[model samples]
Target: MLVSKYFKLNRSQATLDFLDIHIDKDIPVFVDPTSLRSLKTEWGHHCVSLLQNYFSCVLSAIRKGDDERAKTLLSCLNERNEFHLGYSKKKSRGHALGPASADEIWKSLSKSKAATTGLLTDLEDAVLFVDGVGPDMLSDAVCNIIRGPLIEYTQNACLYYEIPMEKEVSSGPVWNAHLERWEQSLIELPLARGAPIILIPKVVVRAKQSYNSNEYYRHYLMPVLQKHHKDTNSSLVHVLKGKKNKGEKRVYKTDLYELYGADKLASAKLTVAHPSALTNYRDAKKSTQAPPLDHTALAKLENIPNPDFPALLNEATKLRPGSKDAYLYEDAIEKFISGFLYPSLSFPVKQDGIHDGRKRIDITYVNSAKSGFFEWLSRHYAASHIFVECKNYGKEVGNPEVDQLAGRFSPSRGQVGILIARSVADKNLLLQRCKDTAADGRGFIIFLDDIDLRELIGQRYDVISGDSNHLLYKRFKALIS
Candidate 1:
């Protein structure tokens, strides 16, 4: 009665489905709070403390007419400028007042009472005195320095911290940009760019009303204060609340303990725990050990054939010339891989290219197999992830196609990839190019054609019977080698 059936889930869809379930169920994800806290302390609080201390010393030296000591302190500030705080506009370069410009600013500051002035005011004056510079640039730099660590800290909090929700978690953006945007928008306000923003999820704060407010406070805000209380002891806690005017927002100020109070601050504690962390937490926690993957289950998946393979292939071939259904081909290839190969693979994340936005990889697999031919290949190539590119063109894939997949390979992203095409007319030539790339240490590329795909799919009956000799994986290994 059923006309046809297709492979059910692709790597990308599977990952999203998993995340959706996890979030919807309100599963607790954990992060290494200690390491994250240390990083925050170093970058967010300690960095600011050192800057303020150096600035105070510089001011003291200048006031006593000790130019040499003042210059020395100024030099210390210049040295710290190496870790500039602006966005990377061109590769690694950012808009920061370099050592030379910093010296110029310090020289001007020393000539006036600006050295003794408020930190933000002094920095603003220096920026104004410098030619061809603006507050935006300086603000970006300062905020980047302070907020950079906080961003990482906030990410950890969001990943691990649990908030009780009555309804299913909304399918929204992974990160609640409310805090990030609020902190960034502060630069445009009367506050300094280096102002610290405590990242408390709106959900957690709102949930405080449902239960004991102290529980929420002890769980969320206490760790932050314990790590950073010294540096920000006298600093006010700034919370961004409702809009002030059209396209503008207001920051509500409060004391450190006023929001939750210091009653249970000391007793509030968090420890590293499992099943309360992001999926990636396991990868981080066990750097040496590969995350567990059900090899038996994945192997069993190959036994199931998509009855609609013939129909799907026919439909693929009949696709109109220059049809926008290129994505259809992508989906087909993804399905083929899932059914014919491993089922534990992770993604072609919704965002085309998870790493580089400019380029989009057709398919990506986080080699999740523990022990198998694919796992062996992963270990051989030292790749934790594998990239696949599918081209449904009526003609043979060329050098440019090979180059595209090769370009995506990197040590971090696994220096191996696969190219799936309708056919490669000049098979020998294409293989030669792949060999050249491998010889050049660029990456290893395995080319798969329509016939190869069908062969793999056709063997499902044998695989299901446990009689097939894993010819698909063997052939792939031979081709790559």
Candidate 2:
């Protein structure tokens, strides 16, 4: 439910649907290179930066004795108290400060005594020493904030394809980067193994709580830290946590000791790695052979209503070239792909691009389906994310058309694309050009005309027969090869 809520909040309906299919069918979701890159570079980096700013602002306010500003920032974290890093019904509050009044917070701050100074006049010092706004509270806030997005990203990765969590070992000496020591314990989500990793900066650890004591941290964060703590070649070295102060930038450890005192500082545990350290090991472990298609599910998918392709084609034929009515062809092709080719595929956005917005990708599909022969063909060509270009032209598709489709190919967007046209006179030449692109390592292009489109629609019901889709794929493969 947390995973569902997270996706509902951040992802589009198409992405939500893609995740739903995997959860309902209990199949692995396949994440393509493009999606993975976006998750790590764009989403991951943005989350880390936001959290760092929040931490810096709160810590700075506390250090400078700005109680009002600190309270305001602390409330931002408290608002999301209902959710934690992991999905569970048992309400473990973790380190979130409860909904106590500002008066109660200030009163506690006034009554509190500093761990080193004995008693404190400054309300900020009292607040730091008191129960609600101490180092532990700050650590927990960082953990909870980081956990929400980290778990969501991990769940999305799992939906992209099923990568099993590393099994827990009964007894092993695990390295604690924060403590700079090794201890004998059950090594959970060991970094030496093949699980995803998220690094937590040592500056964020408030109290030295064991990793497993907190349900969310144990389930979500520990595994990632365990897997990469000792790897020298790991990206952990390049993170913001690992960086040293060059000039005027405040040193994290020194600031904590100066503000929180030596006694309180002794309790803090830290790691010098960015909180969003993620390395996708899914591709290295991807199966060369795809799992078999579920015919029952396919049959059920076929029952879902789709546009009348025959009618769409007739309407498309009647519409003049460059007419806005021709846009119906894109809709028809989208339906054809979703209904006939793969149910997991959904068009999330149209005309997607960056900068000048000169290039508009006609249709982009987020393919989450792991079953079906066509799905296998896509996986075979390493195209988990698919791009489709639809043309309503009555003329033959030329090299220029083929080149446009090929231009969209990348390791992230996928090295395969589909070009749909009303017809083509030089089919051989187009096929030859596609082959040339494939040989050049740019991408593989498939051309579909009116005849192929009709054939796909006609065979939509034949998926129950199991071999009909395979035969169709073979025909397409032969044409392109």
Candidate 3:
């Protein structure tokens, strides 16, 4: 009975009698070689992407307004869909208002009057503008139907991004009416605090037949298993499971999923410390239920006794609790750019991340050569600085971080918003660069190291406020000024 609870197909007589339900004759089911039932349609893949964006927008507060504030946000959402401006190329940029990325578009939508979960039930009016659709079709329409309102509610409902109040996705007020309840939950967690999180199914049952087999197991299944090894060197079954469980441990890898009855795993006993535990803690399925079954489900997995690198780092530091070092961001930026940019640039660097919170400065010097930094400065004024940041814990150094930090824009601060990495990855700066806020990537972040920074020991000149807005370079004011 326990085995049959897991969504399975009945192919045999005994198995059929286990539950005394003859599904084979009454309800015909088709199974491919992999043995798992296929979803209603493949539309799930495309639509799910759009829906995830909507949910994320609603769940985050740092990015509060969506569909509400900015008129240009509509253009950003058009990227993933065949959505058009319905006008000529000349008119395309007309809708290109202030919204930056899809996320930012969500923020603008959140502020709209129509951004609510209840509003989603009104599928008719909303569907008119949607690209392709009918009552029954294999289109991304369903996603759009639910998305518009979610964005509305995110702006209208959620006080913060991370703490959502709704229990689950269904047709109800929890998605809309309970917005205030959701807002209060963010006191502890926030959207800016989000790190990489994922949910991985521990066990899978493949259906029979080439199409179902290849589609279900290979398409959806293998990729996740492969992902388990992205940062590690071992296979899912090998390194992930740790020790062995040869006792009454039930195995489901088989030719026919009939091995599992309808009541099998669908209602199996919670198995914490079994073989379904979330790993790297990134895959945990947390909940606010009075008694969270998901957490109990997570306990099912028997974690490998030990893991190296990040796991070791996690144990040693248990980081991400409070604030992070203000200067650690520079290291990540250097590492990322070293491999990312085409024909990337390189340089020697140092860190001064740790602080006593005693009004210590974030940066001291950069290669003040009158050539790259100072040369441009001399042409205009007298300045020598490439990228320097001041990691302020308060509001924002708005100008310095946004203007000269990133180096991407003509007159950007520091050329990057390099936030100091304390326990979190990049807690200092928000990802999107809001032009309304600051142009050159929001308050460019740069983290200090454990030791005092001494990257540029001896430089010819000093940083000077350059020709404010150089045509092609930054104008620095010489320190000798």
Name the best candidate (by lDDT). Answer: 2
Ranked by TM-score, top first: 2, 1, 3
User: Which structure is stronger by lDDT: 2 or 3?
Assistant: 2
Ranked by TM-score, the better of candidates 1 and 2 is 2
lDDT of 2 by residue, 268-287 (tens): 11111323211111232233
Could you give the C-alpha RMSD of every candidate to the true structure, in order shown?
20.8, 19.0, 26.4
Please report, in order, the local distance difference test score of every candidate based on alpha carbons: 0.43, 0.44, 0.25
The residue-by-residue lDDT of candidate 1 on 318-345, one tens digit each, is 5542337777777655655643443335
How does model 2 score by TM-score? 0.39
lDDT tens per residue, model 3, 266-338: 1111111121211211122112101101112222321212112222222212222223633334333232322
Return the TM-score for each candidate structure: 0.38, 0.39, 0.18
lDDT at residue 84 of model 1 (Cα atoms): 24
Whole-structure CA lDDT of model 1: 0.43
